[model samples]
Target: MSEVQQARPTLLYVDDEDMARKYFARAVGSEYEVLLAASAEEAIATLATDGARIAVLVTDFRMPGRDGGELLREVAQLYPQIVRILVTAYADKDMLLQTVNSGEVFRILEKPLSVAQVREVLRLAGERHRERALRQHRLMAIDETLAFLAHELNTPLAAIANFARGIESRVAGEYTEQRQGEIGQAASAMHDNAQYCLAVLSSFLQSVRNSAGSKAARPEPGAEVSAGALVASLLDTYPFSGDQRQWVQVEMHGDFPVQTLPNCVALVLSSVMSNALRALAGTPSPALRFVVVAQPHLEIHISDNGPGIPPEVMERLLVDPVTTHASAGGSGLGMIFCNRVMQSFGGGIRIASASGAGTTVTLDFPSFKNRMIRSDR
Candidate 1:
């Protein structure tokens, strides 16, 4: 099976009836990884698969041994994240009432169920799963953001302090033009750091405000701004020293078509680029290439000739909702924000890196009607 198939949701159904188990498995097993359990005991055994694979659970209330209610209660304690469905006959009033009131079940399925009803329930269950996943992602993002923010704030604060003290020490000496230039650069870096902090704060505040609102608005297509222009503007605003700024080469390989896209999308792209710059800082060369290419789709590639990520780290970085690297100030928040933005925009971000070669991040945004990239030739 392909990687995508391996990532598909797994549904576990527990029922003592052979025919019911066979039929349900045949109906939904084509789309999902379906696991069958003839008794509650079998279901309990299946739950032992590290609880990482089971996405949903469907159990018959009146199983032969160790009934569904009992099994569900166990599942609730063990795998609370998995959506639970209680299947029962019409006459099982006591069990049905207990299942509904106990809160262990997400939804109850009546026996002799219509295929349409089953499909509808499964559809809603899938939505619930998505929402749960999103919430977990957001929480992880917040954690990573706070970590990165602390690191970002500290670097500049330390620089300002060190530079001021150094300048004071050299005030009485014959300060050369080079010395003066160095002082000025230090000051600029400190200022840029402050500005970056403010931008981050503003983004956080806006997110909070939007979350509190009843209706959230999504930007319409045809309004996409110039990705290159936006990156240039942000780079201009941020606290990059002259040396740091020089290493960041922004190239528009193809005329990047401008399509109306949501502002969050822009922020995501900016954050990833910003992180790339920071990551590149640790390298001896300190060079970063920001290439925006227009092809069948919009491809935003940010690469740096820094110490490339390790194989293990790269693997987790791609799949992890929240992951942090020691060099990136251990703030995994930028990646989470990038992933969330791409998902919302119907696009995706891919990261590639080798131990010594460097790292490249590619953001593929959805294509919409817009002016094509004009050829330079």
Candidate 2:
């Protein structure tokens, strides 16, 4: 390997002045791998070369063609990990200030620059670049894992739900009353749990796909949706019977108000409520409650008065990549998906519960812009 490859770090210097470029190369060459480019175009071309690690960019404010400010803007947008530094003369004070205000350049070194001062700035900039690269790598890894795991898990989960529904129907229709009840209950429970898993898996998959590439398709900017109506529609279509409804008391609190960004908010709320409904078993006073507070943000709080998240499993509920620490009934994908959905829409969820104090998950999505909405009778 060349000495530059095994050296401390590499600095890319872009300037039109051959004398200044030679001077800079000599000043910093011993301590660093100085890649000299006479113009912004050459700097970009050099940056594109394979295995060319340009930690810090030092470019003159005034170049023959594209100036440092213009070149740094493109670099920041494209390879944001590379730190940008503008070198300006005493005459270019106005241009330097303009570049700084535009947030294009990280720092500006005026002419008559000392070697030691330039070295210090380059050191700091290189460190910042490395930190940013690390963060980007981590985010990329998370997105990839989300896609693979969610897609792989969805197939088996769908099959389990289908078979459970089939068994439930056969038992309920053909089996003896005594045995049918037991078999029917088991199948129903399995189907509900599987459906819950599917919802969680699908939500995560959607969020990852959305974040990985283009922006998520936003719903129409302005549309009033009745929260109450949305809830009623889903409840009517959801495959649940009167007996199941009787087993759990479902309460929709507050005079429901119309909210903007309604679809995204509603989908998250419904998923959380559905998960709560599934967890409403093997506990006294099995009930799922929804309390919608319309304020700064459209707040939807769903709570279940079940055994609540156990101390051992509560922390792992939504934090882990795959949370299997939930109750033995359903897959823990529900909370994971819910959290990701909240985060994607510039929203988030807050968890509140003690060991027996029934878990409450609150979702807060952006509210309607400058529009006052009243509850419809």
Candidate 3:
């Protein structure tokens, strides 16, 4: 398509009179591609087909079928991106008052539309649409950056803190069994988490720099690890407090090679474990189980017997970052991170929960035979 065909913003003009529609179209045909509708019903039908292309909707208030206010409300609900203009001959204070306060009308014009006035309003409406779209795009970018940073850096930073504390305790106490094994583990955890932190920061910096035109390079594929060994390594390195480890039960039915990024899998596991432990914090006989299946599909079930999510809260779990432990500095991106990581490798998560029935979260990875179907997207 040529510049003339694609550059002009679309305007949908609705009026009852045929002369008015033709006059309005002739007035603004040079700058805008105007679509005419004889009545509100025809306007809606036009919008239903070309809503995405429409940048502005100017409607006459006193129509035969539905009034302009009704059409404006419907347009606002269905196609909020379309800027709305109300045109009326009468100075009805009640209608104008309601329309103005409701934040639906962008601009109101008199019935006898002036050519200059229509052109200027359309230009201003197009500018407003562009500005609002830019603002929304920026807001979404900020949200995504925040979520990515929180999800990626959280586990390593937390592990570093816990491992440092363990090291401090060992140093303060005498050299015994605690110092023999605990100190080594703490030192290793510290080194590993510190390295992971550095890697995460470097990756984030590269991502920020290349966010616009350039695409970041795909990560190097990690070496395949058996499902059983991966779980063992995760449980051993995970930062667990006193008796928290005892509350967790692991049962591996069989072994299968998992080709997904080990670090990402570890990241997903860390988030799930954190959520499960938080849920079981105050419950009597709290049980957190990691059940692995290596048959048809490689599945890890993280089940916890704690108070299940409320209905209202559960509705927005995967959709938004909803948290129950916001007071404890919870980012509420655990499940979001888990789902994102799993889906990156042709897998997804299944959540089953009720008010008091506890919750079961299953990490559904591709089956062994279908492991090659991993997707980076």
Runs in model 1 deviating more than 4 A are 1-224, 257-262, 321-329, 370-377
lDDT by candidate, in order shown: 0.66, 0.66, 0.72
Better of 1 and 3 by TM-score: 3
The estimated TM-scores of all candidates read: 0.42, 0.52, 0.47
Q: Write the residue-wise lDDT of candidate 2 on 48-95 in tens digits.
A: 761136678889978788777778776654555677898988575566
The numbered model that scores best in TM-score is: 2
- What digit string (tens of lDDT, one per residue) describes model 3 on residues 40-124? 8999889767776788999999988788888887676556567899999999988887787666789999968888898889889
Q: Write one digit per residue (lDDT tens) for candidate 1, span 147-185.
A: 466556656665665665566456545667778767656
Candidate 1 has which clashing residue pairs, if any?
A: 192-239, 222-260, 223-260, 224-259, 224-260, 255-373
Q: Who is ahead in TM-score, 1 or 2?
A: 2
* Candidate 2 displacement at residue 166 in angstroms: 2.6
Model 2 ranges off by over 4 Å: 1-8, 50-52, 91-98, 144-152, 175-196, 199-377
Error of 2 at 122 (Å): 0.9
lDDT of 3: 0.72
TM-score of 2: 0.52
lDDT of 1: 0.66
